[model samples]
Target: MRYSASHKLETREKLLQSSAVSAKRSGFSTVGVDGLMKAIGLSGGAFYSHFSSKDELFASVVESELRQSLERLGAEQDRDKLERCLKQYLSMCHVEHPETGCALPALGAEIARSDIAIRQQAEHWICQLQESWAQVLESDSLAWAILSQCIGALVVARMLATTELQHKVLKSSYDEIGRQIAGPGA
Candidate 1:
């Protein structure tokens, strides 16, 4: 029996959400199309109905995840409490839950080498994220630096084997970011 359009759309959304978590937990390059479809309670063949290839699925996942993260980051923004928002970005919760956290630290390196289309998509979202921060801080340079540091700190922290080291990495970056956000002038 043929599924209705609404059913197909719902199924596609389910696949995209599950795919995002899978890709975030395991790098996009390592997430197989078959396994992803299976994890979402669909046959491996069903994946082809929604996405042409793993690359296509990956692009969708990246776009979905990045958009979700951007909205979250924007919600955290309080012009008078910028550090609080930045703090959320660097929190231990985000560090421990890569599956639902920002895509930059989890997939940035992989996207850097992906096709031009994927890179452009990532760059667009990154710019949006930066623009949100810039609007709150009123300094494009600081916004870029703070966003860069947050991504870098999370990447380094996740790479380390020791929890102590991870905390240290996050702490150092957080302290410095806070300091920079609230300069002597503030």
Candidate 2:
């Protein structure tokens, strides 16, 4: 059966989206190509039609997830809008829902361990996100700091066993970032 180009593209999109959610929810390496394909109602053999290898699929997932994160978290130019984004990002809802939230907190460890090519792809989107904040804040260091804080806070929050501690982790980070953004005098 020969599928049209658009149909192939749609299948690929479904595969990517399903793979990303699975990866974020349960480390990318844990799931095989068969599992990824199974999630999208296709056989494992069809995987090759969309990607050359599992690594290639992973790279695509990384790019897709991070680009989406960039659009959600980095599109703001004003301080108020950025702060609002941060608040939502640092909430318990985000911590409780790794499958649908930003990829950084969910997949940072895997991304750090991936090949140089994957790391570079992650860096491209991450740097673009930082630049958006940098332009708004007028300080590259601050942008980087806040970015790290947000991801780290989420990671730590999710690690804790109790929701109380998780909320503390998130609230503290949110407070500190707000203070930093307000500057020394404020």
Candidate 3:
């Protein structure tokens, strides 16, 4: 049965969204076209009708994930609210739920090893994130530091052996960084 163009587009989008969640929970390379299509209730053969190749689908998925992350962070230009946002971002919930969390912390390594198109998309997203953060920071250095710390902390927390260790890593990193940013004066 032939589907309308709009229906085809919608199905393709659904597949991309599903693939993004799966990629985040597992790894991008591990998400097969067949599994992605099945998750979206479509036949695997239709995958190529939507995407030219797995790489194309991957690039689209990365773009979608990055957009979602930016929206999740809300207004990044307010310094007073940024720390609270960061704390929430690096919390245990974020660590335990990769599918619903930031793609950077969940799939940074995979993105780094991806094709040029994917890497370019990731780089653009990182720059945009950094710029948003910089607007809320006292200096560029602080913005860079905060961004790096948040990503690093989340990655490390996700890699720990136990939930206790993950919580400890997140708490320590959050508290120390928060204190440093707040300073003794404020």
Candidate 4:
């Protein structure tokens, strides 16, 4: 019994979505192909039907996650909207919910450790996101600075043991970014 093309596509989508969430919540390198397949209600053997290897699936996951991030954060055409987006990104909710939030802070280290091809794929999406912001902010450097700060803030906040410290990290980053955006020609 052969599956139809649509069935194959749907199954692939499900696998990608489940694997991405798992990777963000846990870590991509830590989870094996069997586990990823299990998350999508399939056996390990079914994974190769969608992707050649775990590395391929990871590349796909990184691309999918970063593309979604670009869609969410890159669409803001004005400073106010961008600030709101950043605020949400740096919130405690995002810190506590890695599976549902941006993949950067969650998987940055893993991406860095990945092979060159995956790193290049991540770089492409990240650059697209920065370019979108640069258009709105009219400064490439400022866009890069804010992007780095937001991701770093989330990573740092998540590492802290107490909610108070987490909040302090988030609020400080947001407040400083606000000042930077308000200064000079910004």
Off by over 4 Å in 3: 74-76, 183-186
Clashing pairs in 4: none
Which ten contiguous residues of candidate 4 have the minimum total lDDT?
A: 75-84
Q: Whole-model lDDT, candidate 1?
A: 0.85
Alpha carbon RMSD to native, model 4? 1.3
Q: Candidate 3 lDDT, tens digit per residue, 6-87?
A: 9988888899889988999999888788999999998899899999998898888889888777776644458667877878
lDDT of 3 at 174: 86
List model 4 lDDT by residue over 95-176, tens digit each.
9999999999999999999999999999999999999899988899999999999999999999999999999999999999
Better of 1 and 3 by TM-score: 1
lDDT value, candidate 2, whole model: 0.95
What is the C-alpha RMSD, rounded to one decimal, of candidate 3? 1.6
lDDT of 1 by residue, 1-186 (tens): 999999989999999988788777888778677888888898898888888898888888889888987887854577656676667777788888999788889989889989999999999998998998888878999989998999999988888898898889888999998788777756
Candidate 1 regions with alpha-carbon error over 4 angstroms: none
Select the stronger candidate by TM-score from 2 and 3: 2
Best by TM-score: 2
As a TM-score, model 2 comes out at: 0.98
* Error at 90, model 1, angstroms: 1.3
Worst window of 10 by summed lDDT in candidate 1: 74-83
User: Model 4 segments beyond 4 Å from truth?
Assistant: none
Which model is ahead, 2 or 4, in terms of lDDT? Answer: 2
Give candidate 2 regions above 4 Å deviation.
Answer: none
Ranked by lDDT, top first: 2, 4, 1, 3
